[model samples]
Structures are given as structure tokens and as C-alpha cells.
Target: MALVCFGIDKFPDHCNFVNGGDGSVSTQTVEKTSTNRKLAPRYRVLLHNDDYNPMEYVVQVLMSTVPGLTQPQAVSIMMEAHTNGLALVITCALEHAEFYCETLKNHGLTSTIEPDE
Candidate 1:
């Protein structure tokens, strides 16, 4: 008579077992079952105020470079940058924030990304 069992570490007692005709026992222990998963760090995309680019151009760039950014949102960001010297355009994954910042830079706008805290 043999018994084989398989179970996750989180629930050691909760197992599925099978009986073998021979007198042997086997058990499969599931490795660490983590409840918490690490998430990728987020970043903030910022647009800096610059004298070179026009307000309308800034708005256009904001609208086009960042996904889901509406015209009204773009205008608001541009205005904020104009008044405050900088404005947060978006908060997203590092890669996306970098891409957006670079795209804005390509259009002659000052942009930067920083880890979201």
C-alpha cells in the first residue's frame, strides 16, 4: 500500500493523495506560494516650462505624446507649466514615462521623469 500527496506550502494540510498498490509513500511539496507579488516601480512624467515652444504646441505635444490625454487635459497641463514652471503630465510605468518624456523632448519641450514616491 502506497500513498502519494501533492500540496502547496500555504496549505500544508490541504493535499490530494493517491494510493498505490505497492507499499510505498511519496509526497510532492509545492514550493513557496507567495501572497504578495512585487510590482514595477512607477514614475512621474513632468513637463517643464520653456520659452522656445509655444503654448499651443505644448498642448498639442501633450495631447499626442501621452495616451488617453484629452485636449482639455493637455491644455490644462500646458497652462499649469506656463504658470508654475512645470506640470505633472502623467504617472505610469518607468518605460512609458521615459518614452513620453523623450517624445516631448523631441518636440522641443523640456520634460523629465522621476520615481513616484
Candidate 2:
């Protein structure tokens, strides 16, 4: 690319400059980003403590939905939900979080997903 200028009396007929044609100069920079791009909305799925759901059942649900959570970890989460009236079950894409919430509800447990904020 080139830029040119023209004047009637004060300047020359034209002034030209190469913008970016050779390898010596770069006109644009491309940035590489991480491949793990997140497209879905981020959500926090929470389990609400309730009288209808048994503690053991809560633990089971936690273990199943939360990836890498063990039996003891599930129990701990259950206790937190029981005592605190609410506990974060998982942080994930909105679709998965909603699925988890619905599964918990199907199991007769009170659950919901909200924005992480």
C-alpha cells in the first residue's frame, strides 16, 4: 500500500510511501490465544439444603455431578449445603449446570443454577 499527496503550487505533484509490502515491515500483528475457548455462559450450580432430601442422597448426587469429587468430598459438600443452606455444586457452562440442577430436582433435591457473579 502507498500514500500519495498532491498540491497546486506549494508542494510537488505527489509524495508516495510504501505502507507494508516487504518482509522488513509488518502492518498487522496476529495474536495467538488459548485453544480452550469458552462460548457458553458460565454458571454456578448450587444445592440447597432441604428437609425432603436425605443427607446420603445429597452426597450421592454431589459425587455424580461434580467431576473428580470423591465420596468424602461429596459428604463434605453435602454438610456445607446442609449447614449453610446453600453450597456451590459446580462451576461450568450454563447448559451443563442447568442439566445438573434439573437432575438434582428430578432426584427430589432442591437445586438451582445462577450466574457466577
Candidate 3:
């Protein structure tokens, strides 16, 4: 049950050795990798105001179509769209954004996807 610290200056970028109660010693190494690759571009899922779709229907569609959208969040988005001409529902990867946009459209709600700045 003895704990020994090695290369404390390096902290998390170093290795750790632990002694178990069964008289066994284990070695664990912590590694950090630096990647130069850029992340995938994100897209914005926008809900457009419409005359045909009801407010409640828009909220329901937004909550169902987009993942991680809460009821209050959906209502806020719907209200935004109602007040303005459009509202941003979410910012996510292109495929996910497209899927959400399509799902909203299928539910008779006006939605679109555009590259996020």
C-alpha cells in the first residue's frame, strides 16, 4: 500500500507505478499526442418562419428531429423563428445538421442547413 511519485515535474505526461496489497507492482504510462489535423467543418441547422405550421407543431418537430434538444430549448427556438424570420436550432457536423434539417422538413416544418461561420 505504498505510493511512489516519479517525474512529478512532468506530472500527467509521465508514468505512474502502483504497489498493490498483494505484493504486485503495476506500471501505467500516460501519453499525450498532438495532432495537426483540422476538425471537420460544422453546419448550422436553421428553422425558418412559416405561416402554415403551428407554433406547437414547430416546437414538437424541433424537439423530435434534433438530438439533445429539450422542450424549453425547442420552445425558445420556435419563439425565435416566430419573432424573426429564422432561428438557429443547432450547430453540429454537416451530416447531422443535414439529417436534422431533412427530418424537420419531413415533419412539415421549414428547416435548412448552412455552413457555420
| The best candidate in terms of TM-score | 1
Candidate 3 deviant stretches above 4 angstroms: 1-34
Please give, for residues 1-117, the per-residue lDDT of candidate 2 as tens digits.
654444436644443333665644322333445689667778998889998778988898777766798998788878998899998888898888889899888888889889987
Model 1 segments more than 4 A misplaced: 1-25, 29-32
Q: Candidate 1 clashing pairs?
A: none
Report RMSD for candidate 3. 7.8
lDDT of 3: 0.87
Q: 1 or 2, which is superior by TM-score?
A: 1
Q: Candidate 1 residues 1-33, lDDT tens each?
A: 444454446646545444555654455444556
Question: Which of the predicted structures, 1 or 2, would earn the higher lDDT when compared with the native?
Answer: 1
Global fold similarity of model 3 (TM-score): 0.69
- After TM-score superposition, the amount by which residue 63's alpha carbon in candidate 3 deviates from its true location, in angstroms, is 0.8
- Go through the candidates in order and give each one's C-alpha lDDT: 0.84, 0.78, 0.87
Tens digit per residue, CA lDDT, model 3, 2-115: 675766786653667789879898877767568689999999999899999889888888888877889999999999999998999999999899899899989988888899
As a TM-score, model 1 comes out at 0.76
